[model samples]
Target chain A: MTGNREQLLALRQATVSFQGFVAVDRLDFSVAAGELRCLIGPNGAGKSTTLDLICGKSRITSGEIIFRGEPIHTYREFRMARTGIGRKFQVPSVFRELTVMENLEIGCSREPGVWHNLFRFSGGADTERLERLALLVGLQDELSTQAAHLSHGQTQWLEIALILAQDPALILMDEPTAGMTAHETNMTAELFNRLRGQHTLIVVEHDMGFVRDIAETISVMHQGRLLAQGTADEISEDPGVREAYLGSGGIGHA
Target chain B: MSGKLTRQFLIYGAVCLCILLVPVVVDDAFLLNKYARYLVFGMLAIALSLSWGYAGILNLGQATTFGIGSYCMAMFLKLKTVPVHTGSEGLPDFMVWNNVTELPWIWVPFQSTTFSLLAGILLPALFAALLGWFIFGGRIAGVYAAIITLAVMVVANLIIIDQQSYTGGFNGITDLAEFSFLGIDFDAYSASTYYLVAASLTVTLFLALAVSRSKTGLILQAVRDQEERVRFFGYDVALYKTFVFALSAGIAGLAGMLYTIVMEFASPTFLGVPLSLSIVIWVAVGGRQSLIGAMLGAILVTGVQGALSESEAFLETWTLIMGGLFVLIVLLMPKGLAGAIEALVRRLPQAGNGRSARHTEPDHRPETHPNLGGTQ
Candidate 1:
C-alpha cells in the first residue's frame, strides 16, 4: 500500500554525537506518507535519539533531515513542530498544572505566536475538534481534571490526545505504551491501527507484542544504525536481528 | 459564567469600590498621601505576580525597572525645576556642584515632556525585553535566573550611586516642581495626587487581571508547569516569557513614576536590593497566584510596617518583627492568604451539595468518533 505513496520524511546520513560519543551515527531512514512504521531495538540502540534528531530536540553532528521536501535539521524545536511534526516523549509530558481541556485547547491552536493567542479564543470548530480528540483517547470524562491528577495510563493517553489535537501530518511517538497495563496497551494498539493511514507515524517501542498488533512496517536499529526493514514476520526471521537481540530474549520473547 | 467566576468578579468589584472610596473616608491629607504610596506599592506587587506567578519568572531585579522609571520621570522634573531652584545656566544644581557645563546627552531627552512620559514606562519595558531574551533564550531558569536578576539590580543600584553627577548619586534626584497636567497641579500632599495614584492602581489591577484571564495567560501557566512540553506543542516559549516579563516591567515602571510623583523624589533606594526583596515578600504574603491578593498584600504589609516604624518604642525592633512575621507567613501559609480563602470557598459548596463532584459527561463531547473504527 505504501509503494505508491511519496516519502514524507527522510534522514540522509543523520549523525548525532554527544561529546564524541556517537548516539546516532550516519543513519539513513525514510517513511512514506500514510505509513505506520515501528522502530524497535534494545535499550541504547539510539531509537529515542533518532526521534530526538527528527523532532529537533537533539542536534545532528552531521548530515540532514528532510520533511515534506524541506530541510528541517536547521529548524528549532517549536519550528519543527510548526512544520507539522508532532513528537511524544518516552515519558508522558502533558502540562501537569493545566486541565486536559486546556491542554487540548493549546494543542488545537494553529497560530503559535504569543500575540496571536493573546486575545483569540478557540472557535466553535476548534472546540468541537478538541472534544472529539479527547473522546478518541477515552479522556472525554477527564477533560476538566488537572493532568497531574491523571493515572499514568490516562496521562499517556492524554499526551496522545494532545498530539492528535494538533492534527499534524506526521506523529513521532517514543515508547507510546511504555508503562501501560495489558488492556491499556491493547487499546493503544487499536488506536494506532485506526490512525495508520490518516497520519504517518514513526513509533519507537520495546514491546514486540504491541508492535506486532499495529505496525505495518518494522525497522530495527542496532548500535545507531538501521539493521533491518521489512514486515513484522520478516524482521522476526532476520538472522541479524536475532544475533543483535541474542542475550536479550530475541524478537518473539520480547 | 460559572459560580467561581461570578464570585471572583464580585470580589474584584468590592476591591475596586474600596480603592475609589478611600479618599472620601479619610479627611487627613497626610494619611491620604500615605495611602497613595501604599497603592503604588500594590501596583508594583501586581507586576511581580504577573511575571513570577503567571510566567514562572522569579525576577529579583524588578526594582531596577521601578527605579529606572523613577529616574526617567525625575530627570524631566529636575530639568523643569533647575531654573528656579539653583539660578544657573538652566542646568540642575547637581551638575553645577560637579562642575559640569552642559547637560549629558542621556539627560537631554528629558527636556521633552512626551519623551519623559514615554521613557518612564518604555525604558524599563525595553530593558526587560532585552534581558529576558538573554535569560529565557539561554534556558536559564529557577534560582539561576533569580541570581542573574539580583546581580543586574545590584549593578544598576551601584551605577546610579557612583554616577553622582548625572544620577544625583546616593542622594538621588529631589526638590522637583509639582507635576502639572491638563491645567491641574498634582501636588504630593493634595487629594488630586492621591486620586491619580488610586486611579492608576485600579486600571493597572484590571489590566493585569485581563491578561491573566486571556488564552496566553493559560498557556503561560502551562509553560510554568511543563516548559519542555510547551515547546513541543509548537509554542515559542521564550517569546511568551519575554512578553510577560516586559509587561511586568512596564507596569512596575508606571508604579515607579507614580511613586516619584507621590513622594516628590527619586531615590537610589527605589531600585535597591531591599526594595526589590520587599516587593517579592508582598507578593508571597498576599497570594502570588491571585493578582488582587498580591496587591492587597503589598498594601497591608507596607501599612503595618509604616505604623510600626512610626512608634518610638518599636522603631528599632520593627525590622526584626517584620522578618519574623514573614517567616511565619511562609511556614504557615505557603499559598498565601488567597489560596487559603479559595480552598475554604471550594469546600463550602461541595459540603452543602453532598453530590458526586466527578463530571461523568463532558458538556460538548460527542458520544462517539465516527472516524475511529476505520482509517480516514
Candidate 2:
C-alpha cells in the first residue's frame, strides 16, 4: 500500500506509556508528501498523543518515526522543528508580551540562535514577509498590538501565521478551529486548502464539517489504536468508525 | 524610536555628567570614596536586572559571583603586597596567623594582575554557567530556580567561612595593595580610583542597555513569558537562559572587583545572603525590568540609608524604614519606579496626539494586504 507515493512522515510501532498507562499503543501510520490528512477520534483516543510523538514532544517507549525517510524519534523538540516539522498546540501559545509583528519575526528567524537572534533586525525582506504573514492571517491591522490584546479567534489565527512564518515542509495542527466561529472555520479551511500542495498537514480536528471540507484523507483513532483510514467519505461510512464514535459519544449521527 | 533613544541618552548623559563633576564639586575625599562605593553597588543592581528583570531568572544569590570576583582581585593584591622574606612562608598575613604554610596553588595564578582581572570575570561566569546548565537544562525555573540559587549561595558562604586557612575565614582577605595598570597607580583614597569605578559603571550600564534593546533581549523576554513556545520555535531555551545568567554573573563579578578597589577589602559578608537579598531589593525598587532604573535604585537606596544612619533621630529606625519601603514598593509599584516613569512618558505623548489614542482601539475590519509578502 505504501509502494509508489512519496512518504513525508512515517511512524512504525510507535508507543508512548506514562507510568504504566499506555497513552499511545504500538501504531503504524504514514503520511504522503503534500497530503492534507485529518485525524478524528474520541477524547483519550491518542489523537493528540500521536501528534506529540511525531513532533518529539513525548518520548516513545519504542518505535521509529521517519521524517523525510530518516529516523527522527531520537530528535529533541527543537531539533524536530529545525528538521522542518512544525506543531501548533491545541491552545493558542503566542508570546503575549510581544507585538504581533515581533511574534512573527521570531518565527521568521531562520537561525534562531542566541547570537543570531541578538543581532537580528527586522530588515527589508524579513519585514515584508512578516507583513504578508500578518495580512494572510488577518492580523494586518493589529501588527503593532500586543498579542495578549488579540481576540481568542485572532490569537488562534496568529499562531497559525507564526507556523507559516517558519515555512516548514510539514505542519501538525491540534484542534486549529476549536474556538473559531463558523465563518472563521470556513476561512481556516480555505487557508489549509491554499496551503495544500506546498505543505503536508496533519490536522487533528473534532469539527467533522471542517474535516470534510479540508481533508483529502481521514484517519479514525480509538483506544490508542488506528481503527480506520481512508477518504473522509469512506471513513464516515465505515462501520468501525461509527461504532468507535457512537460508543464514546464523540460525534453526532452522520 | 528615535524619541526613546534621545530620552535615554539625555537621562544617562545627565547621570554621566553628574558623576564626572563629583570630584570637582566635592572636595572631601571621604565623600568621594563613599559615592564611588555606591556606584559599585549600582553596578551590582544592573547585573541583577539583567538576569531577573530581562531574562526572568530571579537569581537570589547574585552576591556569590560578586564575592568570587572580589576574592580573585584580593588574592592578587595580597600576594603582591606580602613581604617576600617572611619566615612563616611568603603568604598573606591571615594564612600565617591561622597557621604556618606556603601559598596555596590556586593563589599562584592570581599573582599576576592581568590573570587576576580576567579570573575575576571568568570564574563567576563559569560558575553561573554550570548552575544555569543544571537548572535550565533540566527545565527547572521560576521559584524553584530562585530556591536553588539561594541554596548555592548559602553553601558557598559557609564554605568560604569554613576554609579558614585558605579563604581567610570570617574576616576575609584584606590589606590589599592599590590597583595599578601600565604604571598608572589607582590609590584607594585618590580621585583616580573613583574615576576608575565611575568609568566602569558607565561602561556596564551602556552594555546592559545595549543588551536590553537587542533582538536577543526580545527573545529573552519571550522566553520569560513563554519558554515552551520559544522551544517549539526551534531555539535551545537553556542556551539563552545560560547565556544571560553567565553575562549577569560576569557583570556582577566586575562590580565585585570594583567594590574591592573602593573598599580596600574582600570579606565573607560580600557572599552572605543578606547582601544578595539587598541587591534584589535595590533592583525591585528601581525597576528590575529597567537597567538604569535598577542602578538608580541602588544608588538612591544606599544614599538614603547612609543619610538616615548618620541622622540621630532616624539612626535607630533606618533598618525598619528600609524594610517598610521595600514592602510598599512591592505592593504599590510592582513594576518599579522605571515602569511608573515609562507610563507617564507614554501617556504625555498620547495626550498630545488624539489619533494615537485611537490607534489602540480594536479594529473590527477584516482587511487583507496581499501586496505585503511579495518578496517571500
Candidate 3:
C-alpha cells in the first residue's frame, strides 16, 4: 500500500468530448498509493466525468489512462472495476430492498459468473467478511435492517463500507456529503481521516468545510480544467480560482 | 415472528391448500383436473416474481420461453407418435403434410424424455442468453427491450400459425405422448400427472429461492435499483441484467414443460402475446416484490377464473372479472395480494411481539452512527 503510488493509476492528458462539448479536457492526473486527494468544483465542472473516464465507465476520446503503468483502455467499465478499483456513487446505490448486512455481503461477494449468482449458495467467508466490514463501517448494530429504511448519511456510509468490503486499493466517492447536517458532516470528516493511510481515496465534494478537513491536497476544477491544485488554503487564496468560480459562494459561518 | 408476515404466510398457505384440495372436494373429477392446469400457470408466476419482485426486472416475454419448452415437449411427443414402420422418419401426420422428408436437425436430439426435458429447459436458456446479450449489452433500454421481446413473441406466433402443416399450426401439436419418466407411464389421469406438476412447481420454487438468496440475486437487485451506480461500483450492469434474464427464461421454460404435460396440448397460441400478457398480470397482481406473492397471484387469478367461468351466472364474463382484478391489484395494492394479506395480518392483535419496537433499538443508538452496516 505504501510503495509505488504513481504506478497504480495515471491519466496522461486525457480529454473527453461529448458531441461537441469537452467535459474533461487534457487533464493530467494520477492517484498514488494511500493518497487522499479531494476534487472540488462548482456544479457541472466535470469532477465526476474525470473519475468516470479513468474507471472506464465513460470512454476517453483521446489520451491514455495508465493503471499501475499498464494503459487500461481495453477494459470496459464493469471488467475494469472487477480489477479492484472500487467506486462509491454520489447517491447511495445499495441493494435497498436487501438488508444492510446483505448489501455489504453483496459488495464483498463476487460470483465467478453471472449465472452462478442466481443458483449458488452463499459461502461462509461472504457472511463473515460482511459482519467484520459492518463493524468497521460502524454498521454492526443495523446489520439486518432493510436498506430502504436507512438515513441518507447512513446510506452514504454504507456505500463507503461496501466499497471497503470490495478490498480495493483505490476508492472514488462522488459528493460524499452533498446534503448533510453539521453533525453528520463532521463525523464523515473524522471517518475520512482514518481512511487516509489505508486506502487511496479520491473524493468529489461540494462542502468546503468538509473538504478542508480531510483533503491533504485539494484539486480545484473550473469549466473542465484543473484551475488550482494545493492545500486548502492555497486553492482558497488563488485569485484566478476565486474569480473563475468560488467567487459566488459567499462561503461563511452562515 | 412479525404478525403481519405470519398472517401473510398463513393466508397464502391456506389459499394454496384450498386450491390443492378442490379436486378431492369437488363432485366431478373432470373439473378437478382443470384446476391442476391452472397451478402449472402458477409456477410461471413464481418465476416472474423472482425477477420482477426481488430483482425488479419486468419480463414480458416469459410466455416466449414457456412456448419454447412446450414446443420442445410437443416435438418429442409428435416423434413418439410416428408409425413404427416409418422409423425415425416415420413422420407425424402433420410433418408429412409439411413435407419434412428429413427430421429438423433441432428436433433430433429430443428422442428421449430426459433429453426432451433438458432441451425444453436449455433452449429457452440459450434464447434468453442471446436476447440478454443483445439487450443488456447496452443497446436496448426499458420499453425497447420489452418491444423486442414482444416482437419475438409475434414472430414465434406467426411461425406457429404458418407452419401449420408441420406444427399442427393454429391448433398446435396435440395428442402428446403422456409423460413417462424413467419408464413409468403417465397415460392415466392418475394423481401421477398432478404429482409431476406439483413436483416441478416445488422444484422450480426451490431453485428460485436459491437464486434470490444468492449473491447474484443481490447484484441483480442492485443493478435494478441503480444500473449506473452499480456499474460505478465496478459491476458490469449489463452482465447482471443478462444473467438474471437468462435464469428467468430457463425457469419459465420448466414451467412450460410441465404445462404441456398437464394439458396434453401445445399450441402457438400458448406462445402468443395473450399468454405473455396474462403472466404480467399474474406478477403485478400477486405482488411485485415477493416471490410467494407472485406465485399466489398466479394460482388465485387462474384458479378463480377457471372456477368462476364455469358458474351458471358468470360463464361469459370471467374475462371482465380477471381484468377488473388486475386493475384493482395494481391500483389499490401496489404490493399485490401478498402485501394486502400482510397488512391485514398486522391488525390481528399480536401483543406479545411487536417488530417496530424491536426494530427501533438499532435506530436508537448514537455512538454507532457512522457505521455503514448499523441499522442503515
Q: What fraction of the reference structure's interface contacts does model 3 contain? A: 0.54
Candidate 1, residue A64: how far the Cα is off, in Å: 0.9
- For model 3, how does the per-residue alpha-carbon lDDT over B211-249 read when each residue is reduced to its tens digit? 665667767767666666677556667777777777788
Candidates 1 and 2, the one with greater TM-score: 1
Task: DockQ winner between 2 and 3, please give it.
Answer: 2
For model 3, the DockQ equals 0.43
lDDT (Cα, tens digit) per residue for candidate 2, span A65-174? 99998898898888888889888999989988777877887677468788876665444357677777888889887876778999999999999999999888899999
CAPRI rating of model 1: medium
lDDT of 2 by residue, B134-176 (tens): 9999999999999999999999999999999999899988888
For candidate 2, the lDDT comes to 0.85
**What's the lDDT for residue B54 in model 1?**
82
TM-score of each: 0.95, 0.94, 0.88
Minimum summed lDDT over a 10-residue window in model 3 chain B is located at B367-376
TM-score of chain B of each: 0.93, 0.92, 0.85
Position B213, candidate 3: lDDT:
56
Candidate 1 local lDDT, B93-136, one digit each (tens): 88778887889999998989999999999999999999999999
